[model samples]
Target: MLREFHVHDRKALLDAATQQGWDPLPAEELDEDDLHDVVGAVMWLADSGAEAEGADGLLDLGKARRLRSDEGHEVAQWSPEPIMEDFGKGWLHRASDQPGDSDQSEERTDFAALFAAEPLHCDDPECEDEGCLWQLTPRTADLLHTALTVLADEAYDDAEELGDKRLLEGEHEGNWGVFARMPKLTFAADLQWRRRFARAADDLADDLEHDRWPQPTCTAEELALHFALDDARDLHDELGYEDDADHTALPE
Candidate 1:
């Protein structure tokens, strides 16, 4: 009957199977609707740059599910996620032993020293109480930021397993609360240190322009690094994770 109906009037057959009728329950004849949805989903995946099949030459349902889920979620909310190429090529490559690193090490000394120095302190003559913030340099700040960001953004499966272990150990704190704070703090501190690096970069640039440093304090690579850090800092801000005005580290 279905084949005959399809041969004569395919559109009428599809409507009869999928569209609402007096019956509340789905008609047993509605396999056509399921087939229609599956076919439509496959077409959408193809249009969205998704691979149609896996290595085994079978349709990849896992990818289809993920794409559908992401599309639904994105309609409600969106986030700026780290791109794999950006993380691997730009940030990780610089930190690893690459050809540019030899010169990078030598040039980074001055900025590294500045980064390693004690944090902001009160030097006011009128003030009786002197204070200091976290002893975080730009290098250390970058490390902490990268670690926490990866933990929150990429390593959720590992984090979930770790949470289970913590629960077994009788940890009173919920994993969600415990895991959430570090990324927030590190993100704030990264922005704070970016400003410091930018100022130092400007100072170094001025010194180089005026021939003040017979031995330049920072190399071109280090200056480039400072600007890169600044760009990352600005990106976080644009993503709506506003930098903490206090610029103080959260207690561990």
Candidate 2:
């Protein structure tokens, strides 16, 4: 059976896992066979340690479902890349260092470019003119910092594990700099990216606030809530679909 736990932070996540009789399993350490046991185990951390603090809700990977549409068809899947792309196209507009089909490893500037973009402006009337650009909410700042740190750390660890000398320490160090000094001005920029993505997400839904939701809607937020409530997990387990190798595959 799947278990749900409220982890207030990264250390709490690890502590909970240890108490539950499992070691802290990093994302790179898991294989296909470990998905069932490990996804909900530590996968929640991928969202950001900030999310672990309960601002984003509990860790309940056992309940996630593909967002669906009004026609009973699944909606487009959400991923971070497109949002990153929008960060460049809509905001930063930085010149591509290696344009065209350059591989990701060769074109690692996206992270920095996105990070350097201006932050979202605070909507508070008192802070309107001055803007929260220089003073982002702690939660927002933590989320971005954690995302950069975790990504860089995982990449560095992976490089070391593979004994890839081509991966230099400078790469990790540069990302660490951004992680450490991310300013609030950049929050407005990132917030815009999120707002655009959220709007795109909303367009995919039939009706988000409907009374009979959990049905016509397919927003990531709603699905997340359903997972938190264990409704999705119970339905998934009851249907015997949880055991399938491709449990996440959408219907044709």
Candidate 3:
């Protein structure tokens, strides 16, 4: 039935409509306009589509097509790309650095490309904990900053977890440079210190990648959102100690 519509076989559609007892017009008495109208209505019956589940009303037209179409035929079985199948229903990075097909990884830039700065000295000698620091590129930073802020704001008008704590001793700089001190972040009890860091990460990403969405949806925003979730995972260890982070979290 669907094959008729896919191939635009109006004659086949008319035949199917007659077999199903759905003919609305007399074939022998009809003018060309009447036949056209009946065929067009049959075209709709061929669709038989319904709401796609769990996609927030995004139509899953392909699913309906696959189901109603004959399974015995090879054409009915289609598949998505392998990368999409394994990428955690995840996303691809936008503004991508296209690699040569000869050897895709050969010219690939290392993760260091994300950094804008590196801290030479240990941020805290007082606690005797050793550390290294690297800042994310401004583009990457905005992506991370915005996604986390959006998620956090959706959770709280003034989220404590989104506190922009100062990680290093230098003047506030880089994507990771949130700059609030730890009291609310660590203790989660100090209202005063909590007040300091509140809403720091909010609106961080609004002007950057988010506003440009659909004009050109940025892949960095998705990556940043995942990274922020990682930071939020171990809240117990993160309390009061901003320097304990092995690597940076979603930046300020």
Candidate No. with top TM-score:
1
Report the C-alpha lDDT of model 2 over 1-252, residue by residue, as the tens digit.
Answer: 133444445455555444555544565866777543434546444433433332234322221332224435433345544332232333232355233433333322222222233554766756655445454232222233333333334433333343322323445445433221223332223322333323322332212212112232444334323322343334445444464323222221
lDDT of candidate 1 over 59-169, digit per residue (tens): 121101111332353423444763333323422334454433343433322333334455346765455443453454544443333333332232233343443332222
Q: TM-score for all predictions?
A: 0.22, 0.19, 0.19
lDDT of 1 at 203: 46
> Which order, best to worst by TM-score?
1, 2, 3
Error of 1 at 250 (Å): 22
Q: How accurate locally, in lDDT, is each candidate?
A: 0.35, 0.35, 0.38
Model 1 ranges with Cα > 4 A deviation: 1-33, 39-46, 49-122, 125-136, 153-155, 159-252
Q: List the residue pairs that clash in candidate 3.
A: 146-205, 186-239, 186-240
Deviation of model 1 at 74, angstroms: 32
Candidate 2 Cα errors over 4 Å, as ranges: 1-8, 25-41, 44-188, 195-205, 208-252
Please, what are the lDDT tens digits per residue for candidate 3 over residues 11-108?
A: 55555555555546556766876655554445445544422111122111111112112325343245553322343454343444333223332332
Error of 2 at 182 (Å): 25
Weakest 10 consecutive residues of candidate 3 by summed lDDT: 58-67
Off by over 4 Å in 3: 1-7, 27-31, 34-41, 47-251
